[model samples]
Target: MDEEQLKIMRHSCAHILAAAVTELYPGVKLGVGPVVDQGFYYDVLTPTPVTEEDLVKIEEKMHEIIAKATTFDREEIGLDQAIDFFRERHQDFKVELLKDLKEKGTTKISVEELADVGDRPDTASLYRTGEFVDLCRGPHVQHAGQIGVFKLTKLAGAYWRGRDGNPQMQRIYGVAFETEQQLEEYLVMLEEAKRRDHRKLGKEMGLYTFSELVGAGLPLWTPKGTLLRNILDDFVWQMRREYGYQKVTIPHITKKDLYETSGHWEKFKDDLFRITTREGHEFVMKPMNCPHHTQIFDCEKRSYRDLPQRYAETTMVYRDEQTGELSGLTRVRSITQDDAHVFCRETQVKEEAYKIWDIIERFYAAFGFELEVRLSTHDPANMKPYLGTVEQWDGYVAELKSWLEEKGLPYRMGLGEAAFYGPKLDFMAHDSLGREWQVATIQVDRNMPERFGLHCVNEHSEDERIVMIHAAIMGSIERFLAVLIEHTAGAFPAWLAPVQVRIATVSQDFVPFAEQLGTELVAAGLRAELDDSDEKVGKKIRAAAMAKVPWTIVIGSKEAEGGDFKINVFGQDEDLVVARDQLIATLLEATQRPS
Candidate 1:
């Protein structure tokens, strides 16, 4: 189903859930029922804490309500009647919401913003099923019975209206699908996702850790995690190097004047970490590297021949993210970006972008990700928020669109999604579980160059304005690794695995041979780990396998005497016995970059 249709179904399902909850607990006050990605959740104030076991009874009640095949009748009432209606039902949460809407003089709501309440005063639409009523602007199913196949997944505590120190409410989450088969497929995927969840696997595999003492949203990489990150960094550097990108470095913090010149101080000052020196100079942790890269470009003179000076860096940027918004590597305060910027003549914009597209394709293809393209353009209704003039915006947007068309790339146009400075081409990738993520991005910026007054000598030996290209293949290294870990289930490919090969001898007699083999592999540019633990060889092999090593080498007496080693490849049955010379050659070739 399309997103809109799916959202309608999920929202209908949420109403049924709320109705069931209200019936089960007479005094429950309804907060809100919103349809989120993958599911829907309803927040309600209950008399007591709702545990996981309560979900069964609630779900059973929901099924009963659905079986009744009751109609969902929508009605429009006066602001005061709506308040009185919810007040008499003991749904103070709903009554409070209506009061806010009434005070804001809300008279109409857009169909697109059906679930977005409180943010703006809009029309108040109410829906009723049987005797249960809710204040919502909904396009629900024709009847309660048409909610499709759904399952209550979990429960959590949420504050009323999402404010801290507010009354806590029980939020029940569930998944809904159009058919039973689709629901089953989604459930199966959920099971696999749980098994592959980075938060869980990272701990079990010793990949990374978090401590309250150090802080939240800052991950401490273990030896294994650091190895994986380093390998990824090397690969990205090599790829960018081939694309004519030169490495550069910048300080983590800069004087406030730097951002003020770049417009970030006015736009994102609140989202930055500000510091004050004893001398009273204000500094802020750099939230992005594009501004810093531009200073480097301006530090030197350039001509048309020097156009497309691509500078690349893998550096960490800090943002003042709310603590509650923090998750594992996916959402963090400190983000490491594989960031690069290109300063080019206006005539070179398309070529520079083409090069960036190639880099992005090669990087994601290396990991087997499928991509979708989007051309994010300016919103004409609100030009005041953007930095450049309408002519510059329209001209660059037309050029980008023409370039995309000339290349015959299928892309979706996103209105009002452009950065405040310029348009961008965003690439969304599909992971192993069929979930899509916004990955690489290439943004065309004329504003920053103008702000910095960047220029290059044209063919006529006259100063001309230049354009900037902001490219990030791996948007955030931490977020990328989190997705990668979950996508691969921590079983990284042979070339990327932290421990490429694990060697364990059958007994003390073969220990020396195993150590020699480990040394050989290491010398051949492989990450080899020798199992020197006191565990038996079988147990050691199992441990290595659990660690997700790409291969495990067993050194037995036969191998020591016969000069043949057995290699057990991960995710494969049966072992292959080959001469040590042949194995070393195979590993060396396997680890090298594909030509």
Candidate 2:
């Protein structure tokens, strides 16, 4: 089925799930059920705790409900009547939601799932599927039979309305598709994704670790993980250097006035880690680098000859992310951004943006990632959430579109997805698994320059306003690594692998030779490790494989006595035999970073 149909079906399936749950355990107060990326999840406060084993029974009940072919009937009820109706049923969550809608429209409701409720001041919408009724503004499937195929996947605990100190609700997750084949294919991909989960592989490969003392969402990178991050960051820097980008540094904490001037204070103040000085001065940990970079550009007077002052920095920014929102690398409290900004005149915006595009193309190309561009523009309907005038926004957006057109790059329009200050070209990369990730971005900002009064003396001797172009090749190093680890399934390419080559001896007698070979490989610019312990050769090989090293060389008596060495390549069935010099040459060539 088409995407819209699939969404409607999945949403209906969520209602079906709620119906089954209510029947199985009566007196369950429903929160909300929303359609997510792969499927749907419903949050409800159940009278009795629900276990994973109960999912099977819930699925059976859902199937029975679907077999009945119940129609989804939507009704509009008066606000007071809906509140009383839910209150009578002891669905305190629904009553609270209805009351909030009655008093404050939708502004007071923080639950994202209920934002779509097109409720009038006097009335609210409700959907009825069999005996289960839910407060929803939905265009659901006509009947439960249209749900096609569905499976209850898992369950978790969630705070009511996603707020702390609130009653916790049971969140039941499920996936639905149009056909059995599609469902089976998705299930297989999910299994493979689980196998390649970065959190599991990272621990197994000793890439990074998380400790309770370090707190949630704060990951501590191991030595190898730190090396991997440096490699990626250096590669990005190399590309930026070719475009005349200069490195810059900024303090991690700044006076609150800095962000206030840049407009981030108003929009992202809640996410900032605030600090108080001894004298009671307010400061905030930087959550973004663009604002600080602006100050660097403004530090000196400039002429039009000095236009496009490119400043690049790889630094960690702090954000007070909720613990529940934290995941492996992807979502973290501390984010490492390979951020750069270019201060240029209006005439030079395209040229500077093109330079960034080149860097981005070359960077993702090294990983064999196919990119799809997205033109994220501001929502014309909502002018309050953005900065700059309509004329400014329109001109900047048109300029970005023209760049994409000139490059002949096909892109999708993401309405209402632009940054608060400007429109951006978001690069979405398709990995080996066919999963898409938003990897890089280039934004044209006329707002920040205007806010900071950044300008340069023009040829006409006029103080001409400059434009700021925000560019990030890796966006966030942690998130990019998460994607990279999963995309390669921990078997990174030779140049990118943390441990490129592992040298193991057949016995302790050849330990010196293995150590010597390790030094040679390292001298040849390969990340090599020696397994000189008294473990058996087979065990050492297994250990190397577990570490996902690209190359593992075994040293035996023959190899130790001036003979060609056999190299075992990861993911290959055959072993390559080459002279010592030839092996070093091959590895040096393979491990060379992309230019």
Pick by lDDT: which candidate is best? 2
Model 1 stretches astray by more than 4 angstroms: 77-123, 157-168, 389-391
Give TM-scores for every candidate, taking all chains together and pairing residue i with residue i.
Answer: 0.92, 0.96
Pairs that clash in candidate 2? none
Q: What is the lDDT for 593 in model 1?
A: 59
lDDT for each residue of candidate 1 in 263-375, tens digit (9 for 90 to 100)? 98877776799999999989999999988899899898898898889999999999977564577899998899999999998788888899889888888888888898889
Candidate 2: misplaced stretches above 4 Å?
107-120
Error of 1 at 422 (Å): 1.6
* TM-score result, candidate 2: 0.96
Give me candidate 1's TM-score against the actual structure: 0.92
Tell me the tens digit of each residue's lDDT in model 2 across 303-349.
Answer: 99997899999999999887666888999999999999999988888
